[model samples]
Target: MNLVLRASILLLVLAGAPATAFAQDASDPIGNILDQVGQPAPATPTPPLPVPAPRAPPPAVARPTPAPPVAAPYPYGPRPQIAAPYAPSSSTYAPPPPNLSPSLAEPVFVDEYDRTPDRPMNSAEQGYENRMRSSFAAAQGMQGPLDGAWTLRSDAGQAVYTLLLVDKNNGRLEGAWRDPRRPGSRDSSGFLAAIQKIGTQLTASFYPSPGAGAVTLTLTPLGNGEWTGELTEGGARLGVVMSRN
Candidate 1:
C-alpha cells in the first residue's frame, strides 16, 4: 500500500511541473553547444513577405525636335543657264540677191473707193497708218533666197511632185504634194506651222488636216541657194533636198 501511495505522489509532482521547466530543459543542450562555439542561437524561421509587384514604368516621354540640316555652300557659284540643244552656226543666211529687191517683193493692196463724203483723218489714225506701213516695209525687206518656190526630187531623178514656198515677208510656209501621173489628184497642201529660223537653219512644223499625227522639218542651208534637211514624223526619218525653182 505504501509503495502505491509513493508512486501516486511522484505522478502528481510531474503532472504539476511548469511548462517553462520543460522548454528550458529542451533548449539547454543546443544552447550549451552554441555557447561552446561563441555563437548566437538561431532564431525561429519566418515566412517570406509577399514580393511587392513591380512598379509600372513611367509613361514614355516624347523626344526633343532635332536641329535642321545645314546646306553646303556651292563650290563654284549659282547654276548657269541651260545650254541650247545645239550651238547656232556662226554663218548667217546671206541677204537677198540683187534681182529680188524689196520693191518687187512688196504685196499690192487695193482698197475699194468710198462713195460717201470724205472725212479728215485724225492724228491717231495717221500715226497708226504710218506704223502699219513701216512694219510692212520691214517685213518685206527680210525676204531672201528662201522666198521662191522649191522642187524636191528623188535620187532616181524622178520628180516627187512636191512644191514648197516660203514667204519670209509674212512669216509663212506652204507645201503641196500632187500626183503628176493622175492629173488632178492632190495629196496635201496647207500652211506650215511654227516656222523658226536659227542661223542658216530653218525648222517648220506641219500637221496635216486629214492625217492622225504631225511632222517637223529641220532644214540647213547648203549654200548655192539650196537646202538639205530631214523630216521627222511618227518615228520615221526622211532626207530631203530642195533647190530654188
Candidate 2:
C-alpha cells in the first residue's frame, strides 16, 4: 500500500511539476524517486569488537630466576687438601740386637728359695759374734738387721768409709763404698770385680784404682747386725768392723 501511495504521489508530482523539473531528472526519474524514499534511519552505532585483550602474551610463562653462582674460596690453582692417615714405612723398621745388656735387657723375674727361713745360728756363728765383740773396735749393738748403709773402720780406728749393702737380691749381693773425706769421689763402684761365698763368709775384691791391685775383704757375719771383716791392703791383713750407720 505504501508503494502504491508512493507511486500515486510520484504520478501526481509528475503531473503537476513543470517540464523544467522533469528535464533535470529525466534520465534517472525512477532512481531519483527511490533514492529519496530509501534514505535509511541513522544507523545504531556498533560497539567495537574487544580484540580479545591481545591474550596478555600467554602470561609470560612465569620463567624462574636463576641463582647466582658461588665463588670459589681458592679459585686459581691449589685446592684444599685432605690430610691422609699416617702410614709407617718398612724402611724405618729396625730389628733389635741379639744380646742386650743384662741390666736393661733382662725382664724383671723372681727367684725361688731352696732353703728354710729363720733357722737357728750354728756354733760358728756364736764364736764369730764373740770375736767381733772382743776383738773389733767401735763394735756396738744395731737397732735392726743390717741391710743398708754402714761404716767400715780399722781395728785401730782409722780410715773410715761408707759401705752400702742395699742391692742384695735373691741371695746375690752387690755393694758400693764411698770415702767421705773426698766428696764426690767415686772410690768404689758397686760393680764388684770378684766375689765368693763360703759358708757364712763372703770374700769380695774392690778395684779402687785402675792401675793398683784390688783390695780384698773377707766378711763373716757376727749373728748381730754387723760383720767381723778383715781388710787385706798391700799384703797386710788388718782387722776391721762393719756397723750400721
Candidate 3:
C-alpha cells in the first residue's frame, strides 16, 4: 500500500511544473544549462578563407642608341707664289764705227779761175772786166764825157744819188745807181738797159735791184761836165741834174 501512494505523488508534482521550461530546453539547451549553473553562453568559431596564387611581373623592354654626326670640308684652297723679273748683261752693249769718207776727213779748196779758160765768161766776170775797161778808157780819154761816176742832184741842190756809166767790149752799155747817204746801204748798184743816144740826147732804163721794174731817164748834155735829165718811176717824173763826182 505505501508504494502506490508514492507513485501518485510523483505524477502530481510533474503536472504542477510550467510549460515555458519545456520550451527553453527544446530551443536553447546550453542556455538552460547556463541558467542552471549561473554562467554566460560561449560564441561559435568562424571558418578561414582560401589564399590565391601570385601573378608574374610584366616583361622588360630594350632601346637602341643613335650614331654620331659627320663633319664638313673647307670652301677654298691655299694661294700660289709669284716669280721675279729678268735683267740683261753689260757685255752686250757696243758703240758704232767712225766716219771715213774723203769729204768728211779732209777739206777741198778750189781756185776762182781754175775752170775752163776757153768757156764763155759768166755775167759776174764780164761785169768786172767791163768796169776795168771803162776805168782804163777814162784814163786814156777814149770814152765820152758820160763814161764815169756822176753826182745827181734834185732841184733843191741836195745830192740824191750817184750814177756810173761804163762801156763793154761788145759795144753794149751798163751802169750803176747808188744812194750813198742811206744808212746801212750795201753797194747800191744797178744795171742800165735799152740805152739809145741821138746827138747827146740819151734815153735808158735803170733797175735799182734784181727782179725790180725799170726806171726811165731822158738826159741832154750840158757843157762843163754837167747834164740835165728827167727821171720817171711809176708814171711820176722829177727833174734831176748831174755833175762829175
Candidate 4:
C-alpha cells in the first residue's frame, strides 16, 4: 500500500507539467534563412525644382535718302561786210544819148479822152487835145528836151488833160501832167498831180476835194525812173510842171 501511493503522486506531477515540454521539438537553419530573403526592400524619398520656357530675339530700323544735280549755258557775238560807200545824185542829172533819130526827135504824147457818159467829143475837145499834143511835141523837138517842170493856166468851165513823156535814154520822164478836164483826173483840178506807171502804161490816182481852199499835189517816183502823181483837194483846176532847171 505505501509503494502504490508514491507512484500515484509521481504521475500527478507529470500530468501537470507543460505540453511543449512534453511534446517533441524540431530545428532547421536553411528554412530560417529562406524566410528572411523573401521580405520586400524600403522605398526612396523625392527632390522637387522648377523648369523654364524658351526666349526670342530683337527687331531692326530704317534710314533716309539723298538729292540730284544741275547743268550750265552758252554765249554769242557780231559780224562783218563787203562793198564801198556812195552819194545821192541830183534829181536833175541828165543821162547822155549815143544815137539820134528824127522820129525820136518828135515828141510822143500818151493821151486818152473820156467823153461825158454818151456825149461826143466837141470843138473844146479838139482844142484840149491839140493843145496838149502840140505842147508835148514842142517840149521834146527842141535840142533842150521837155523840162521836168512847167506852168499851165486854164478856164473854170473847160476840159481836163494829162500828159506823160518818158525819156528813152534815161528811162525817166521830164514832164508829167494831168488836168481836171482830162481822162482819169476824176478828182479836183487845183493840186499837185498823181501819176503811177506799170510797165509802159501810166495812171493818175485822184485828188479828193478838201472843202476849204487847200491845194495839194503828191508826186512819187517808182524806183526804175518811173513815177506816180496826183493833184486835188481844192476848187481851182490850175498847176504847173517845172524841171529842176
Candidate 5:
C-alpha cells in the first residue's frame, strides 16, 4: 500500500480501537518515558492583573464674591456730604407771619365757664356724685387697711373736705384736712364745713356753694400703713390721702 493509504488506515484503526486497547498501562514503556519528561509541565496560566476602577468626579462648589467691608453701626461711615444752603429757586413757598393773631371773640367758653362763680347750676350736674363715687370705689377698693378713718365724697361738686371726728358727747362732728402739697391750705381764705359719716360713706356740707364745694373720696384699705383714695368734684377729679396719726 502507498504511504498515505497506510497512514489513513492506521488512524482509522486507532479511532475504532476499544478504550482498553489504548489505555495507558503502568508497565508501558511509552508512559514511563513520558513520566520522565514530565509532559513538558503544563504552561502556567498567567493571572489577569487587577485593573483599578475609574474614580468618580468631585462635586462642584460655588466661589464667594469678595465684598467691600461694611461700616460700623454707630457713627456709621465718614461724615455725610453737607448740602449747600439753597438759593430760592422760585417764590412759590412763603414764610408764615411773625404774629399770627388769634380770633378774640371766638365765643370764649373756657374762661367764661371756669370763672363765672355766679353761674347757676346746669342740668349736667345731676348724678355727679354717683359717677364720682363709682369711679372712686373702683380705684380705692383695689387697695388696703383703713381702720377708723372714714371716707367722704361729694355728690354735686369738687370739694376740699376736712373731717374732724367730733366727740359725740360735745355734739360737734369736727375734723380738719389740708392740702398736703400746699404748705398752708387753711390760710387760703377757703371756708370750713363739718364732716359726717353715714354707713360706709361720709358726707360734708358747706355753706353757700350747695354741692359745688363738696368732695367725695374713695378709700381702699391696704393691710399695711397705706390707703388709696380717688376724689371727684364738679366735673373734675382729684386724688387725696388721709393718714392715721
Candidate 6:
C-alpha cells in the first residue's frame, strides 16, 4: 500500500513540471529522452564559440607625384655674376704654318710710330705718342669691375695702359694690349690678340710687341683685385698698377 502511494505522488510531481524543462537538446542526444527515464538532465554546456582570428590590415597603395606645369616657370631675382672656372696660369698655342713664318702669320696689328732708320723718337715725339695712347685707352669704357687702367708713374705724371679683353676660345686668351712699348698692338683683326698668360704673372716677353727691349714688370696683387708693383725697364723700376679687363 505504501509503494503504491509513493509512485502516485512522484507521477503527480512530474505532471506539474514546466514544458520548457522537458524540451529536446539537439547537441546532446541523451538529453531528449532523459525525462522519460525520470533522472534530472545535466545542463548542456554551450560549445565555446569559435572566435575568428583578427584579419591582417590591408597594405597601403603608393601614388606618383605630378610633374611641374609647362606654361609658366619659377622666377629667380637679378642676373648673377659668373667667374671663369680655370686658373689664370693656363695658356693655349697653335703651331706656326710650315710655309709661313710667325711674323708673317701673326703680324703685329699696327705700329703708331712711323719711325724710319733716320727718324727717331725725340722728347716731342714721345709726348705726342703718349697723348695718342692715352686717347686710345680712354675710348673703351670699363666693361666690368675687373676692367680698369694700368697706371705707371712717369716724370710728366701717370702713364696709362689698357689691356682690353674681348673673348676667349679654345683655351686662347684674346684681347688688345698696350704698354709703354708697342702700338697698343693686337695680333689679328681688331678683336684678335696674342697675350699669352705664362704661369700666374705675365711679363712683356709673353706679349708680342715692339719696344725698346723686354719690359719687366714686378706686379704684386692688391687686395681689391688690382695689382700694385713696379715696371723695370732700362734699369729703373717705376710704381705700376695692373688690373683685369
Instruction: Quote each prediction's TM-score.
Output: 0.35, 0.37, 0.39, 0.18, 0.24, 0.27
Candidate 2, 123-166: lDDT as tens digits: 77779967876753333232223345667788887655666663
The RMSD of every model to the true structure, in order and in angstroms, is 23.2, 21.1, 31.1, 25.2, 22.3, 24.1
* lDDT values, one for every candidate: 0.61, 0.65, 0.67, 0.45, 0.50, 0.52
lDDT digits (tens) for residues 1-245 of candidate 5: 69999999999888877664546554477876866784666789999999999998998988999899977655677666689997765486564454554445333322122333233333555478568879976765543323223333334333344333333333334544433223333342233365544444444433424335564555554566434566666646766554443
lDDT of 1 by residue, 67-158 (tens): 98765556555555677797555585443355533343322311112222324445777899789989966775787556645655444545
When sorted by TM-score, best at the front, the candidate numbers are 3, 2, 1, 6, 5, 4
The C-alpha local distance difference test score for the whole of candidate 5 amounts to: 0.50
TM-score of 2: 0.37
The residue-level lDDT of candidate 2 at 187 comes to: 52
Off by over 4 Å in 4: 1-139, 142-169, 174-188, 191-193, 211-245
Best candidate according to TM-score: 3
Which consecutive 10 residues in model 4 have the weakest lDDT in total? 70-79
Best-performing candidate as measured by lDDT: 3
Point out where model 5 deviates above 4 Å: 1-164, 167-172, 184-186, 189-192, 205-213, 218-228
**Residue 198 displacement (Å), model 2:** 2.7
**Which pairs of residues collide in candidate 3?**
none
